[model samples]
Target: MRKPWCSTSSLALALVTVIVVGLAGAANAQGAAPAPAGPPPPAPTADEIKKVTEYYLRGKDVGPILMELVVCKKMGKSAENKSICEEKHGDTLKKGDPLIAFTRFFVPKGAKYEDLKVKFLLNGEVRSTSDFTLQESWTGYGNYKQTTASKPGTWEILVLRGETQLATAKVTVVE
Candidate 1:
């Protein structure tokens, strides 16, 4: 019953209304709240946090631990002289005497990670480099002894974890 021209006009109007509505929806979506400033920090899972807490409570380390070093000479020709015995044994080192390096690594109980390599530096030059760990056979924690070069200079212990230097201890050798 509708006229032909009137029907075509209605169809055109409907199409225009649809386009306007679509445009309004697009505008509303664009005006809405922006996403966020930057990416939010990644949320750590509950299990991950619990594991970290457990490790901290039990004193477990991942990266690096504390290191202690002492440089000294033997007391005399006693049996203890052949070994690193007491602190007094680590006094000043003399020429032609034994240079003992006492080192202690702070780690969890039963953790025997021997990834530490130490270099005995005499006057900024590497005299010796070796890997050692806690040993029951030794008198002290980690006792490393070598004959003195009979040269008066500076003595340094460079502690390295992999290629990185973790700690350093130094002493002076006298004639």
Candidate 2:
């Protein structure tokens, strides 16, 4: 005959195993919680784009200007054989992310603290602007290592030197 204590111990073990298996099954049925939805898409209307583009093109306050985008590494230098300022500034820029280092440039050689005016444009609309004295400079060129939050889309940057507007660079920032 089996010992009474042995039978009790075996029963307890089986009960525990069943409970664990049941809990595991329940957990598997639940699975992981569904991931939260992301933010809504940002799409500009055709009219809006036209209006913004017209504003930049028609603005007479600043003289004729040409803009370009430049992309580089974190060392504040242009990457090898990479266009410093052209259609695209950086390889990638996320929505609401800060400005990437070594991804921007301007003309007019060294911009004086009082003779510089910089503006950021999203889809041709002005999003932000800063003067030369307001922010620190990167070498003789404008600073690019500073962090500044920006919306994702076709972006353009305008740099003005005194009364003469220097250059503007456009880039696409993906979401």
Candidate 3:
């Protein structure tokens, strides 16, 4: 009989070439090559990221809402749990008068109970800061108690969520 058109070794070599090409094409079609085998990355450490002081509403980019911010002579809540402001005064506040900075706000849906901040500033200087839990209807208040050391000048109240300033109210304080 005539010798086979291809030797056994050549057939084997041809078969190996076909398999390598097929595997390469399949890999390309699937995706990139597999990652090199190695030890897993080190676990993250707590100090890697700084603690976040500001928080977003409902994990969304939206911020909280401040409906009304008033600086009044007196502030209290009614028996029905509604806010009451007496002698609403923003034009000028008498030094040593019972001064109150009250704010009514609406926390975004799913953001209620989250922590917010109210800052009391006197002539652009932070006098005090208070934290309040966002309520469904209204929340926030800061008492600008006029102490002997309390300076008489422009007083401001600011509502903030994290680094975002939501609202601000200004009142002039007089001696």
Candidate 4:
């Protein structure tokens, strides 16, 4: 009796099967989830980028003046070794999503060393406050993660040095 040809083709198929099974087993063992099957969301627009940098200075030109502000979902480092927004947000943000703010300031070298107050306001009410010490011409950031109790409305971020307001930024929260 002649046996069927199960030599080269059969061995090659068997090797492929083993390799696929091994890869699947490894993925399962490591708890790896496949990536989403689509392109990422588009980048922020020029208007959106401009909105974040728009701030009102409350007093005379002084040290620690807020130079640039950015609201983003995440931040990343650029190839030039500078900080950049990974996911820039527009004026409206999801109610339950975290609010992240990055600020750049021009602090005169001779400026007094003091704490700058960061205020988070909802409508006209002060929702939260924190202190960030001014660095000599440097960058700082704040993050407010929302909870189930978080409400939707207009929110403001005010940076103050003592009683004098340095700058103010605003955003809207929506469901």
Candidate 5:
């Protein structure tokens, strides 16, 4: 009887030891590695990043106007602007006109053209605002022409649907 009791106690102690070791191994595995920390990854840019601002003119959903801004360092070399002086049809602007044009993109998938509102902002302040009505579709490519009132600093083109702001762009204006 004494021998059997001693044998059972030894088996129980061995089992406890094994259980403790397995629990320790699991704890170490759970704390094995730490996650990396840093700023969010940058947005991918195209080889030619066409900066455009969208103006939501009509509909319940406003979209953005897109424009391309030439960066100063690559201005004379990489950037190219073809003049439309050949015929009267291409002359969207008169001589010595101070205006910036942008292409608009609308939102909410099937929104009509007559239901949007668009606005332009300079350094977080409103510079010009406009409204449009879509007779046919919800969104299409369009342009907004704004004459420069003062030397362009930091300008933002914002699109809105009703009261919600959809998208925005920040561009530096050069004299």
Candidate 6:
């Protein structure tokens, strides 16, 4: 017969201990406890977009920003041929120039975001609307831009996510 030390209760206790130790080991294998969770930051508004672009991109004095139009720019084509500001900044684009838009920017954590709602404003009027979705990359920054013929004036480009503006720039289009 079996010994008293190998009773049913003893086996059950041993099994539980093994299970507990295995679970603890698994948890340890995983990294440390994640940071406290909370609601994400509210997307900045058009007004907020202006402020941020001004602070980081532009100085206290909001001066006119020239659009960096480009020729070999791909609005968003093949996977390998997608346009990026870091790659293609701007080209020569004149007034009444169809599909003449210099599209690209350096997003802080662009990959974490969605397609940004973009608007091209002239002098203060809305010229065109474009939405940008950040493509995957080695860096968090991504690029997406829209091209449309513009009139001769100051083209205020506002990059937005919803009503909140993410970035801003000004481009002078001449005739």
TM per prediction: 0.48, 0.38, 0.53, 0.51, 0.37, 0.41
Clashing residue pairs in candidate 1, if any?
Answer: none
- lDDT, candidates in the order shown: 0.54, 0.46, 0.56, 0.57, 0.41, 0.48
TM-score (C-alpha, index-matched) for candidate 2:
0.38
**What is the Cα root-mean-square deviation between model 3 and the actual structure?**
23.5
Model 5 quality (TM-score): 0.37
- Which of candidates 5 and 6 reaches a greater lDDT? 6
Per residue, candidate 6 scores C-alpha lDDT tens digits across 40-149 of 77766656644533333333132222223343223444443344322333433467654433433333211234546667787899867876554322212334445555
Please give, for residues 1-175, the per-residue lDDT of candidate 1 as tens digits. 8657668657755765565466446533433212236889896775764453344335434543544565655433444233333443343566666666555444432345566777878799888888765421111133454445467788777777678887776666788
**lDDT by residue (tens digit), candidate 3, 58-166:** 4324545666676667644443223455557757777776656666554433455455777888889988887766532212222222222166898887877776787
Q: Which pairs clash in the backbone of model 6?
A: 44-164, 45-164, 45-165, 65-170, 67-171, 68-90, 69-90, 69-91, 70-91, 115-132
- Worst lDDT 10-window in candidate 6: 60-69
Query: What TM-score does structure 6 among the candidates reach?
Result: 0.41
lDDT of 4 by residue, 1-175 (tens): 9986788767755765565466446534443233336998787764653332232112223545666666666655444223445576788887787666566564443344466776778897988877766533212222222222167998887767788886777888988
Off by over 4 Å in 5: 1-101, 104-113, 138-145
46-130: candidate 2 lDDT, tens digit per residue = 5664443444334334322233334422332334222232222365666765553232232221222455566777788877766
User: Which 10 consecutive positions of candidate 4 have the poorest summed lDDT?
Assistant: 140-149
Error of 1 at 175 (Å): 2.7
- Structure candidate 4, residue pairs in collision: none
Listed per model in order, the count of residue pairs whose N, CA or C atoms clash below 3 Å is 0, 8, 1, 0, 22, 10
Every model's Cα RMSD, please?
A: 25.6, 25.4, 23.5, 19.3, 21.4, 17.7
Residue pairs with colliding backbones in model 2 are: 66-168, 67-168, 68-168, 68-169, 69-85, 69-86, 70-84, 70-85
Better of 3 and 6 by TM-score: 3
For model 1, how many clashes? 0
